[model samples]
Target: MSIQNSIETKVKEGFLALYNTEIPTVEFQATRKEFEGDITVVVFPLLRYKKGNPVQIGEDLGKYIVENVTEITNYNVVKGFLNLVIDDSFYTNFFNAIYSDATYGFVSPKADEKAVMVEYSSPNTNKPLHLGHVRNNLLGYSVAEIIKAAGKKVYKTQIINDRGIHICKSMLAWEKFAPNGSDGQKETPENTGLKGDKLVGNYYVKFDQEYKKEIAQLIAEGKTEDEAKKEAPLFVEAQQMLLKWEAGDAEVVALWKEMNSWVYKGFEVTYKSMGVDFDTLYYESNTYLLGKDVVAQGLEKGVFYKKEDGSVWCDLTEDGLDEKIVLRSDGTAVYMTQDIGTAIQRVKDYADVGGMVYTVGNEQDYHFQVLFLILKKLGFDWAKQLHHLSYGMVDLPSGKMKSREGTVVDADDLMDEMTATAKEISEELGKLDGYSDKEKNELYETIGLGALKYFILKVDPKKRILFDPKSSVDFQGNTGPFIQYTYARIQSIIRKADFDYSQPLTIELHEKEKELLKQLELYPETVQQAAANYSPAIIANYTYDLVKEFNSFYQNVHILGEQDLNKKVFRVQLSKKVAETIKSAFLLLGIQVPERM
Candidate 1:
């Protein structure tokens, strides 16, 4: 249990025993930045019982609670709140207990005793991943990590949208413009392989322009409008191609096989660069047909009915939702169809599985809400286990990122900019020493990727964030690089010392050190709360606070080469311990720290 919770529990027990009414929910307010108290508790909730003068009431209750609770060494009433100071022994015990045990502050013995599945980064293959996808990837990755650390068994997966009309647009453009341009395997003399997604994407844009022009030109020829459209060759060809591909036409399949492999390779490279991972990858080409059998069974079970237009419909108006399309009129499955199938398949495949969580965007909230409700109607009793971890869209300083507007921030480009910025700053400061080209590249990636992940994870999951290329990604003031710098400083401290652990140590616990240790004690509680609520931002915020405190201590206290050698040894050990704690915290938040930054 966390110290805050322990304190809350103690306060609640005392209040409940004294007041006799059902104990009010106890809340331990976080220590204010400028405050000297360990924690502040608002006594306003009990004001009515103490005859309404809030300040006096707070005073009386503060006295009674402090007198009764031995943990409260000293406490006072300020305004209508009780400012309680805990004993240093609590700080000593808490810090020792906290920093000693691992889990980096995550709580154990998870409630509900069930399983969870998290699906994130469901990227379409028609384009390379961009900044929006980066947000999705980091949120999904960190949230899954958070949940797992909280003691739940989490399954992380992704759905690859490889087969669709949009993808066909890219293929069409490629066929018309780049007939023999792509070997897909060819790295040019410059050693640049045409990136699969980009190579494919440019053609998609080309197809749109050329197809529109052709349609307009044919319309100007005074042919009947419907006739002009009907004579469009690309659509006819693309449709025929899709049919052929679906029918196992050997040549078309081979082309698709080769093209998709290249795209996946490009995607893999990007995923590696960004440090995202997946336990499983579900392909639309393979899983698109997945729900047909289940949807059929659902129809038989009266979960769905045939529409007048011969499409399959699930009537949800009884539950205040409109009737939804299940299967297309042409017997083809749409997005919802594939999802229904995937849900059923997952259950059957992992029969002992506890639940599934989709880390999709907020736009898909209606889809999953409807999906889960439909599963319930289909008599899947375990369907209630489904969850949707909906996240908001990421906007830039200009506006919302739009691909057509050319405002989309490509993931590769963003990382490159960040890496270059880190390198530029490092070089200007003359910080890196004797680094080879490879080492410099790797260092840039570590810091650069850390910057990106930290930027995305710092914001609350529900609120949309506006990214300022300058201020938002800066290294100082609650950023990942700041934490990395603290880690490196600690490493430097450790490297300069060969201290004796066998000697008996007495902790003087100076003001800054005590406050820092107190904050360190809060780590486990922070992790538990963050993991429990699926918020990595909490961990991010805590990590920044820890480093900030460490920096304060670093500036004031001398750890190495202290006049008192024994004190130097103790501070060195403390520095080592802080480094260890920060590294673990960074890992939990899905950021990595370079040994030197």
Candidate 2:
């Protein structure tokens, strides 16, 4: 058991013996720095059960603990707080126990545990991913890794928004504006040497431009703004195209498949570059009409009602939400309908999936709320397990991004920019003196990506981010490269040790060494807390704290240079463990560390 748990058990025993009163729990916090103790037990909460001076009560408990708890060597009472100083041997034993564990803080999933499906990077095929998508992917991937480390099985998945008016807009624009006819002569990713998604996305922008021109011309011909917008020739043609695509017209389907294939290839390159992946992919083209059958079942069960216009909706006003439409008036499935069907289809495919996490933007918070509620109302037992990982917008310094306007910070471009920044900064610092050009470039990529991922992941997910690329790549402060550099320093120490430093030893602990060990002890608990909160920020900050502690120890204490062989070996061991913990924490955040940076 943890020291805190043991203390709680003993504290309850003390309460029963002293005042003949039963206390169910105890509250403890890290002792303040000014206080001469390692842990503090708050005596304020016990006043309700045992009516007396809190200071006296704390003194009595401290005496009881020092007498009964062997690990606690000494104690002091400050007001209502009882502070206990633990023996150094306890920390030494704890360090020894975890020293050889390569995966010390991770727990493996048990056989009976149900799997969690984490859906992230659910991007549209019309455009490449951008900065906002970067945050989503990082957050989702990190959360999934953390959950796995906390002993739960996890499956990464995404739903591709491959079919919609937005996609058709791109296709229509490409067909009308490409240099040649819509055949082999058309502008392809190969001939143009442009990414497939970018090429397709350019056309999406072109469609908007042309559509706007048509709308203006119609308005000039004495039509109202709304009338012109609806009556524009381009708009009508796009609607017709959608209808034909839904009917599975061979020619339209062929074109859609070809263009979407280009987009899929483009997305593969970007996802690879960003270091994110999914175990399964659900396409809207296949799942768009899915929830129609479910809607019919809901109608029979009186969970939904059909209006005179033939639109289907679930009445949720009684449950404090407005009625939500599941199907259109023409019997076509809406987005909500498709979402319900897709969620159910996932369970059918993966029987052991007990819950799903939707890593979507906060704009759709209400949508998820309704979706989960409707599922529960429809009698899905697993609906209660659903969660919406709602996150705020990520903006660049200039401002927000608009995909159709092509003003967004493209994911590929952002990553390339980070790499270039790292290269510049590393060269300026002259840290890569002996490295070959190839090795230097690879290290730059690692540092660059690490900075980008760490800067974004270290913030609370719900908080908006104003990302500055240059600021994120800094070599100092609470940044990814900073922590990574510390790890590299420890690696250098390991390499420079000429003699064996692996033997177990007992030595007097320096204050810095003790502080570092205290920080290391929190790693497992940090991982568990990060998983429970579904927040990568917790792990990211914990790693920063550990790095800070190790740096302090490194600066103030001697490792290999120490004359005492036992002290030198123990310090080396402590440094190695700290480096291992940093690597493990960074792994959960999807950040990489360089051995020499």
Candidate 3:
């Protein structure tokens, strides 16, 4: 049993024996820094069972704990808090047990545990992934890793929004504006020497620009702006194309396949650059009509109602939400319909998956709420396990981004800029020595991407982020590069310790060493907590705290310079373990730690 568990049991036993009454449970917390203890037990709650002064009760319990608990060397009572100072041997033994464990804090999935499916980066094929998608991808990927570390089978997946009017807009723009060559073929990613997604995205913007001009022209001819928008020639053609493609028009379907193929290739490049991958894939083209039959069954079961106009709706008014449309009046599937069908299809594909997490932005908060509710109303037992990982938008100092205007920070471009910034900063610091150009470039990438992922993951998902690329790559404070640099520093130390340091020794611990051990001990619980909350921010902040504690220990203790062999070996072992834990925690956050920086 852990020392804390033993202390709790003894405290309960001591209370029952002394007060002649039993307390149901015990409350424990990390002892305050101002107090001289490792753990604090609140004595105020004990008064409910037996009325007495909190300070006297604390003193009595402190005395009983020290007398009964061998690992607890001393105790102090400050009003309602009973602070217990544990013996150094407990920490020494704990360190010894976990010293050589490379995967110390990670747990393995049990045989019978149900799997979790995490959906992220469900980007539309019309554009390349942007800064907003970066946050979504990072959060989703990190959460999946944390859940896996916390002992659950995890599947990372995404559903591509590969159909609809938005995609048609790009295709129509390409057909209308694409330049022909001597061979009589229009521009392609190959001919244009551009990424497929970027090439397609340029046309999406082109469609918007031309549509706006047409709207202006119609308004000049005395039509209302609303009417002009609907009457715009480019938009009308795009809509017609969507209909034709839906009806299996060969030409339009061929164009969609070719364009989407290009976009898929480009998407794969960006996803690889960002270091994220999916276990399974779904496309809107395939899943768009999925929920139609289910909607029919729901109508029969009275879970939904059809309007006189032939539209299908779910009446959620009694549940405090307005009626939501599952199918359009023209019998076309809505996004909700596709989502419903796709969710059911996923369960069919993976029977072991008991739950799913949709990593979508907060703009779709109402949409997901309605979707989950309707699914539950449709009587899927697994619907209870569904979660929407809604997160706030990521904005830059320059202001908000618009994809149609071509102003959004492209994900590939943003990553390149981060790498450049890292290169610039590292050169200014002039730390590179005896390193080839290739090694330096790789290190810069590690620092840059690590900085980007860490800065975003460290923030709570519910809060909006104002990301500044420059600040995120800094080598000080609670940043990713700072932690990476510390890891590298430990590596330098490990390399210097040429002597054998593997032997376990029982010695009186330094104050800094004990504090570091306490931080190290929190890693396993922190991973579980991060998984429970579906937030990488928990693991990120915990890692920062651990690094800070290790730094304090390094500054105050002598390792390689120590004359005593036992002390030197123990400190080196402690430093190595701390580095391993940092790497493990950063792995959960999808950040890489460099061996040298």
Candidate 4:
């Protein structure tokens, strides 16, 4: 049993024996730094069970606990808090127990446990992934890793928005404007020598620009803005193209497939560059018509109602939300309709999936709320297990991004920029004296990517972030490079330890060493907490704290300079364990630690 668990048990037993009162629960906190203790017992809560001065009750309980618990040597009562000082042997034994555990904080999934499906990076095929998608992918990927570490089977998935009017707009623009190749064929990724996604994305922007120009021309000729927008030739043609693609018009469908294939190829490169992956994929083209039949069934069962214009909707006014449209008046499916079908299809595909997490931005908070309610109304048992990992938008220091204007920070470009920044900073610091150019380049990428992922993941998901790349790469304070540097320092220590240090030795601990061990002990619980809350920030902050504690120990104590061989061996062992723990924690955050930085 953990020392905290033992203390709780003994505290309850001590309370019952002394006051003849049975306290149902015990509340504990980290002992205050000013206090000489490792753990603190809040004695104020027990006042309700047995009325008395809190200080007196604390003193009595502390005395009882120290006498009964072997690990706890002494205690002090200040106000209602009982600070218990634990023996050094407790920490030493704890270190010995976990020293060899390579996967110390991770738990394996049980075969019978239900799997969780996490959906992220649901990007439109019209544009390359941007800064916003970067945040979404990082958050989703890290959360999935943390959940898997906490002992759950997790499936990473995404639903690509590969259809609809937006897609057709790009298609129409490309057809009308793309320059022909020398072979007399229209521009393609191969002929143009541009990334398929970027090439297609340029067309999406072109469509918007032309559509706006048409709208302006019609307005100049005396038409209302809304009428001009609806009547614009580019938009009208895009809408017709959508209908053609839906109806399986051979030429349009072929064009759609070819263009979408290009976008998919481009997306593969970006996802690889960003270091995120999916276990399964869903395309909107395949799933857009999914929930229509379910809507019909829901209508018959009174779960939904049809309007006078033949539109289907789920009236959620009674459930504290506005009425939500499921199908359009012309019997076409809306986004909500497609979502309902796609969700059911996923469960059919993965029978063991008991729950799903949708990693969407906070803008769709209400949409998810309505979707979840409608699913519950339709009576799916797994509906209750649905979660929306709603997060705030990511804004750049310059301003917000606009994809249609082609002003967004592209994911690939952002990653490349980060790598460049790392290279510049590393060179300026002059830290790579003996490294070859190839090794230096690889290390720069690792530091660059690590800095990017860490800076984004360290923030609370619901809070907006204004990311600055230079600040994230600084090798000081809460940044990733600082932690990475510490890990590299430990590796240097391990390399220099010529003598064997694998043997675990029982020694009287330094204050810094005991604190480091305490920090290490929190890793398992930290993983569980991060998974439960669906927040990577918890794990990130915990890792930063652990690094800070290790730094203090390194500064105040001598590892190799110690006269006592036992002290040197124990310190080396402690330092290696701390590094191992740092790497493990960082892996959950989707950040890599370089052995040398």
Candidate 5:
């Protein structure tokens, strides 16, 4: 049993035996720095059952614990707190048990565990992914991994917004302005030497530019702003194209398929480069028409009502929200309709999936609230398992990004910038003296991406981030490269150890060694807590703390030069375990660790 559990059990017995009163549980915290103990028990809480001064109560419990528990050798009472000093053998035994464990902090999912589907990076097809989508993807992928480590089955998935008026805007723009028209000069991704998504995205921007000019011209010709917007030739044509595409017009449908295929190809390359993947993919085009029949069913069941204009809505005013429209007057499904259908479709595809997590931006917090409530009102048993992992926006120093104006920070570009920064900093530090060019480049990418992922993942999801690539790649402080360098340092130590250090040994522990072991003991609990909170920042910060403890030990203790063979072996083993824990924690955050830097 863990020392905490042992102490708690013994303390309860002590209270019952001395005061003749039964206490259900005990509260414990890490002993204060100035206190001479390993763990502190707050005695003030037990005063409810035993009538006495807290300090006296603490003294009595401390005496009872030391007399009964073998692991706890000594104790000191400070006010109402009982500081228990555990024996060194406890720390050594704990270290020995986990020192060689390759997967110490992870749990294996049981055979019958229910699965969870995590949805993220649900990007519109009209534009390539930007900084916002980058955050979404990284957060979703990391959460999925953490959940798996916590012993749950997880499926990573995304829904592509492939069909809409926005997509038609890009198609219309390409047909009207491309050099060869749609059939004349085909601007295929391969020939243009651009990513498929980027190629399509250029046309989207072009459409906006021409649409604005037309709107301006119409306004100059004696039209109101709203009238000019609706009458603009480009806007009218795009609307017509959307209608035709929905009707399955042969020519329009063919073009839509061709363009979306290109975007999918480009998205694959980006997802691969970012080191995130999905087990399944859903497209809006296929799922948009769904939920309409469900609306009729809801109306029959009185879960929804028809408006005077024939629109369908769920009256949420009673639930502290305004009325939310599910379908338009013309029988067109709204975005919420598509999401409802997609969620149901996923459960159908994976029967074991009992819950879902939507990794969407905080802007849509209200949308998800309505979505979940609607699902529950529809009477689905699993509706209660739904969660919205709402995160804040990611902005750069240049300010917020707008996709239409082409001012957004592109994901590919940001990644490339990070790599360049990593290379620049690594060269100046002369850390690649003996590495080959290929090895150096690979290390640079690993460090660069690691920094990017870590910098973002380490912050609370509800908090906004102003990301600066330059500062993230720093070799010192709470950055990814700093933690990575410490891992490499430990690797160097292992390489220099000429004798076998894996044998078990018993010896008096140094304060630094005991401190490192204490930090290591928190890894499993950290993983579980991070999973429960659905936050990768917990794991990220825990890793930073562990690295800090290991560094303190490294500076104060000598491994290779120690005269005692047993002591040297134990220290090296401890260092190895610390590196292993770092690698494991980084894995949960979807970041890579370099063996050398």
Candidate 6:
């Protein structure tokens, strides 16, 4: 239950004395800054049921609420909107209730019973994870956490792209150039040798460069351009190698397994550093082929058709989407085919009532549009439950990150650079100068990751982001370190206070304390909205706002060492509640706050 629920209950009791039946949920919304009220009851949604004009019904409800509801000490009607001023004593009681309990700022009664499946971080084995993947992972992970906090059972899953022509290109490069991790310059801490994805990414580059060279030479020898590119043995070999691996050739399978494992090892470290973990892992190597059978079934059932070239396709033209191919002419599954199969597999494997996939890219909006349409056409009613949590791209100061130009922000490298940069900044601020190597490492990583996640998640999901690396890395303004610092400062104050805040509240708080508490009071509602809309940025924005408000309150007001005992006690309790609330919000966003950061 929430404060609004209690207010509504009292309003209903008054209305019941005057009417016959029950009132619906109250129209509770936060008031505008100009309105000298705590909440604005937009009773427009209820006027129809009252058998009167909007203004008349608004007046009746306003009187009914104020006369019976103790929470609203005074209220008035303005432009048919009921603006209610909550009693200052309500703040005193709110603190009293919160001081003895930890779960202060959330709704208790949960809605419905279905599960939410959140899919994210669907990276490929052929290349290193980039800044784009990092944003995707953070948003996806944070969304899952927020949904869970909203009292929904959420399943976090990752679909790894472990097979296909891309995977084989790297394998082929490794086979010819540096077989079995013995390139005579294998990766070591001191050496510049790359990890699995980077190593494989290098080969992907090599394959492209070498293939282009081979084509140029062939065209020079009088072969046609198309023929020169087509007959290039490197691509042909790579394709053949994929076919061989798909056919379960022992050596090819072994090499594929070896490469993907190395990639996993590298990815795991990054995931841990970012403080995210998946509940389930689905490999495309396994699911992509399975999708082929689903496509075949769909074709047989008239949900799809065979093109002139014998490729499997679905006509989504009715939905303004183009005809999409599910399988190649060679009877191999394409991206769509594999995805259809994976959807069915997850539904069966997890027994999930529904799913919410967070891919976090604007480019694939068309792809998911096709994906969900195809699933519905296949007669899976649960297809309606599928969602594409598409987020915008992370552009740099120059422009969009282009991989071929070698300007893409590699995830592992970005983490390293941010951590080092964080350490440098911390040292300059004298925040981590006397810290030991391990403590410095801890502070650097916590603050670095917090900065990265906040910068990426601060903007609304649909808006394209321009990340000026210089401007985003700063800790002085609306950054992650600022929030963490607020928490640290609160903790510092609490430690120095003579009174214990975990005890029951015994006094009325200050104006700033009451203000911070009011914001904290809406955490549950904020979380529920984020989960309902499938947007983690909402929670990110809320957490940052909460931190900012608390920080402002801390800077202006002295909590510890106050002259008045009541003021001192009140400040200490307020600081304690803010710290607890901040920590909880940070955890919901998959961010960790250093005890001292």
Task: Give lDDT for model 3.
Answer: 0.93
Evaluate candidate 4 by giving its C-alpha RMSD to the native, one decimal. Answer: 1.6
Candidate 3's residue-wise lDDT over 1-597, tens digit each? 678779889989998899888888898898999989999998878889989899998888889989999899999988899999999999999999988788888888999998999999999999999999999999999999999999999999999999999999999999999997445689888877789999999999999999999999999999999999999888889999999998999999999999999999999999999999999999888898899999999999999999999999999999999999989999988889989999999999999998999999999999999999998999998899899998999999999999999999999999999999999999999999988999999999999999999999999998899999999999999999999999999999999999999899899899999999989888888898999999999999999999999899989989899999999999999999999999999988888899998
Q: Which regions of candidate 6 are displaced past 4 Å?
A: 6-36, 42-60, 78-81, 103-112, 179-193, 223-225, 299-301, 305-312, 327-330
**lDDT by candidate, in order shown:** 0.75, 0.92, 0.93, 0.93, 0.92, 0.77
Query: How does each model score on TM-score?
Result: 0.89, 0.97, 0.97, 0.97, 0.96, 0.88
**For model 4, how does the per-residue alpha-carbon lDDT over 113-148 read when each residue is reduced to its tens digit?**
999999999999998999999999999999999999
Model 5, 1-597: lDDT tens digits are: 678889999999999999999999899998988989988999988988988999889989999999999999999999899999999999999988987789898999999988999999999988899999999999999999999999999999998888889999999998888764344466778667789899889999999999999999999999999999999999999999999998899999999999888888988888998999999988888888878888898899888999999999999999999998998999988988877887888899999998999999999999999999999999888899999998999989999898988888999999999999999999999968889999999999999999999999999998999999999999899999999999999999999999998788778999899889889998998999998888999999999999999999989999888999899999999999999999999989888888888
Give the worst 10-residue stretch by lDDT in candidate 5: 178-187
After superposition, the stretches of candidate 3 with alpha carbons farther than 4 Å from their true spots are 12-25, 45-50, 180-184
Q: Compared with the true structure, what per-residue lDDT tens digits does model 2 show for residues 1-597? A: 677878899899999998899997899998999999888999999998999999999999999999999999999999999999989888898888889999899999999999999999999988888899999999999999999999999999999998888988999999899875345588999878889998998998899999999999999999999999999988888888889998889998999999999999999999888888889989988898899999999999999999999999999999889999999999888889999999999999999999999999999999999999989988998899999998999988798788888888889999999999999998899978889989999999999999999999999999999899999999799999999999999999999988887777656688888889889988888999998888999999999999999988999988888988889889889999999999999999998899998
Write down the TM-score for model 5.
Answer: 0.96
**After superposing candidate 4, which stretches have Cα over 4 Å from the reference?**
19-25, 181-184
Candidate 2 TM-score to native: 0.97
Judge candidate 4 at residue 263 and give its lDDT: 94
Tell me the lDDT of model 1 at 462: 77
Q: Can you tell me which runs of candidate 5 are displaced by over 4 Å? A: 12-25, 45-52, 180-184
Candidate 1 vs 2: which has more lDDT:
2
TM-score of 6: 0.88
